[model samples]
Target: MKIGLIGSGDVGQALAHGFTSEGHDVKIGTRSPRENLVSYSDASSFGEIVVIATPWSGTKAAIDAAVAGNFKDKTVIDVTNPLVMRENGPPELALGHTDSGGEQVQRWLPGAHVIKAFNIVGNAFMYKPEFPHGPPTMFIAGNEGDAKVAVTRILTSFGWETIDIGGIEGARLLEPMCILWVLTGVRSGNWNQAFRMLRK
Candidate 1:
């Protein structure tokens, strides 16, 4: 699969490497595409799947600038959270409890199949994950069943145990998980911990 990544930051780089290592054609898109990196055009042309890994603030613009026309039949994985980061302290969710970044992305790209994944896991664990025990759960939610399945397979290839948390509305809850992830990182001074869904 040809994967188009919209950001070149930590999350983008991590997922790019993970996918490329799995033998998938990966293109990392940036506002300023360098020699090694590809432009948004390169991404759009090579896309089988497009992953929006940009910061919460630039999510809409990135999508608008990256893809042309309606991404109606394409699966666009939204890995962003509406976290408003302050210079003095940690990040907070900007959209509040009612709406989420994933939903907002879906709203902007109305025709695209938006799936929320990788928002709960830290960047450190995004690749071929090796926990103390077994594979950690990756929570995913989307309105499209087929899109979710494709995302699940990709995530599982990267060694994640996927959990389908219903439809896009589930993002209302999933986006807050970023706050929990960051809070745990700040409180314990460890950003390596990831949430795992266990059925008891």
Candidate 2:
């Protein structure tokens, strides 16, 4: 599958590598292609699916520039969190409680089937994560069942234990998982930790 990664940042590049390593073609959509990226429109046209990896602050503009209509009926994986860094201390969520970045992305691109995933974990564990216990669990939510299924297939390929927690509104819960993930690293200075679910 041709994958459109709609950001040139770390998340986008990491996912690009993961997708390519798995035999899928990837094109990164960014403001400048000269910096090893593709224009949003070109990347959208080149892919069968798209990934939204822009920082929460630039998400709206990035989607707008990517031509929202072009994503109609396409599966879009939203890998964003609404945290903005403060001038003083730790970053804070820009939107939450009542709304979330994933839901907002769905609103911006109404025609696209948006699924929220990869926002709950550090990028280091995103592709082929190895743990002493088992694969880390990934939680995803989306309105379209088929879209969630598509993301599940991709996640399974990349090595994750997927747990579908329901519709897009579930992002309200999933996004916070990122805060917990980051706080561990911030408080302990260890980025090697990951969360795994236990079930009998």
Candidate 3:
């Protein structure tokens, strides 16, 4: 599988490395047209799976610049969160409590199948996560059932147990999981911790 990543930040880099290590062709997209864009555009033209890893603020522009129409009929993994922090304070979600970044991305790219995954967990534990017990659970949601299944397979390949939390509307719950994750990191200085869904 050829994967096109729209951001080169930590989350994007981690996922790109993970997929590349799993024998997928990976292209990291940037704002500047450079060494990778030619091949990246070719992959996009050929209908490769694209992952949007840009910051919440830049998500729309990134999708717009990447040509969302090119991603039509393609599965897009949305891993962005809309949290803006004040100086030395806790982060505030830019989108209202009812809305989420994933839904916004979905709205922007109306034709693309947008699945919300990897937003719930910290990037440190995103690829090849190792826990004291078994694989950590990852929560995913999207309107397209098939796309969610594909994303679940990818999550399993990356060493996570995936839990499908229903449609894109579930993103309202999943996106803020990042806030809990970051708060834990700040309070305890543990960046590697991940949430696991437990059942009796």
Candidate 4:
């Protein structure tokens, strides 16, 4: 599988590494990319699946630059949280309740099958996370059932137990969970924690 990463930040790089470990070819898209990196358009056109990991603020621009049509019919994994940085404390969600980053990304790439994922945990735990208990749960949301299934397979490869919460609107709930994750880390000074769903 050819995977295109829309951002070259920590999250993108971590996911790229994970995908490569799973035997998928990966390309990272960014402005002013270095030797191995490629432009957003080039990466998007080359990938079978496109992963959007850009920061919330720059996400729209990245999509525009990537040529939205290049993502037509492609499964797009959205790993962004609508966060606004705060000088006083942890970042705050820029939008919620009615709107979310995942929905926004879907709107940006109307031709793409967009799935919301990987925004609830830190980048360090994104791939092959190890926990004393067991593999943590990753909640994903997307309108298309098949697209969610595809992302679930990728999550399983990356060592996560996945739960499809519902349509992209579920991002309204998942995005806020990211702030909770960050707040917990800020309070405890531990970035190793991840969310798990208990079942019997």
Candidate 5:
């Protein structure tokens, strides 16, 4: 599998490394190309699966730059949080309750299977995370059944327990969960935590 990552930030790089370590060919897309990074269009065209890891502000532009057709019929993993940071305090969701980044990305690439994932945790744990209790749960939201399955497989490979929350609209819930993660980190001053779902 060739994984194209649309954003060379921490999240993208982390997932790219994980994919490569999992024996998949990985390409990172960026505005500034370098030895390891390729242009967004090139990366998108090169991948069997595309990951959208761009910051929320530039996600649309990155997708546009990658060419919408390049994502056609491909599984697109969205790891973005639509945040508006401030100097005074913790960041807040740019939009929520009715709209979300995942739905917007789906709208942007109607031909692509956009799945919202990896946004609820920090980049440090995006790949293989070790915990004393057990593998943490990763909640994914997407409309396509096959795409969600694919993402769940990847998450399992990266040492995660997954729960399919159903449809891209579930991002409305997942995105806010990101805020909770952040606020918990801010208040507790611990960045080394992840979420787990308990079953009785």
Candidate 6:
């Protein structure tokens, strides 16, 4: 499948390369295509699936740049964290409790199938994450069942086990795990670890 990535940052680039390595056609969208990325509008229309990997703060702008109607019924992946900078420290979720970035994306692209994933781990561990412990779990959610299934297959191809925690609102639960991930990194100076769920 052709995958269009809406952000050219670390997360976007990492996943683009990962998918390309797996023989999927990938295009990255950014302000600078001279830097080997495509313009946002092109990307939104370029792929079978589009991934929103822009930083939380830049999400709206990225979405606007992506040609509003181009996303209709397309599979849109949300890999962004709503991390708002806090004074004297790291960031916290800007939209949560009652709403989340994922929900906002759904609102922004009302016709798109917005599935959230890959927001819980560092980009370094996103693709083919192999730790001594075991395969990590990727939690995903979306209103579109077929879309989530496709994303689950993508996650598995990227070397992750997955848990579909239900509809888009499930992001309320999944996004917080990102906070814990960042806190663990800051506190331990280790950003290499990924989350895993064990069941007997």
Query: Candidate 2: misplaced stretches above 4 Å?
Result: none
Model 1's alpha-carbon lDDT is 0.85
lDDT (Cα, tens digit) per residue for candidate 4, span 123-158: 999999989899999999999988998999999999
lDDT of 3 by residue, 54-156 (tens): 8877877777778867899889898988878679867878885687888888899899899999987878789999999899998888899888888998999
TM-score of each: 0.95, 0.96, 0.93, 0.98, 0.99, 0.97
List runs of model 5 lying over 4 Å from the truth.
none
Assess each prediction's global lDDT (C-alpha) against the native: 0.85, 0.89, 0.83, 0.94, 0.94, 0.92
lDDT for residue 173 in candidate 5, whole number 0-100: 98
Error of 3 at 125 (Å): 1.4
lDDT of 1 by residue, 90-180 (tens): 8878985677788888888788889999988788889977888788888999989999999999999999999998988889898888888
Off by over 4 Å in 4: none
* lDDT of each residue in 64-126, candidate 5, tens digit only: 999999999999999999988889988889999999999999999999999999999999998
Q: How accurate is candidate 5 locally (lDDT)?
A: 0.94
For residues 1-200, what per-residue lDDT tens digits would candidate 2 score against the true structure?
Answer: 99999998889988998999999989899887776688998887777889999988888889888999889999999999999888876678888899998899999999999999999777877898888888999999999999998899999999999999998999999988898888888899988877788989
Error of 5 at 139 (Å): 0.2
- Say what the RMSD of model 5 is: 0.6
Ranking by lDDT: 4, 5, 6, 2, 1, 3
Positional deviation of residue 50's Cα in model 3 after best superposition, in angstroms: 0.8
Tell me which residue pairs clash in candidate 2: none
- Count of residue pairs whose backbone atoms collide, per candidate: 0, 0, 0, 0, 0, 0
**Stretch of 10 with least lDDT, candidate 4:** 27-36
> Which 10-residue span in candidate 3 carries the lowest summed lDDT?
38-47
Better by lDDT, candidate 5 or 1 = 5
Q: After superposition, how far is residue 18 of candidate 6 from its true place, in Å?
A: 0.6
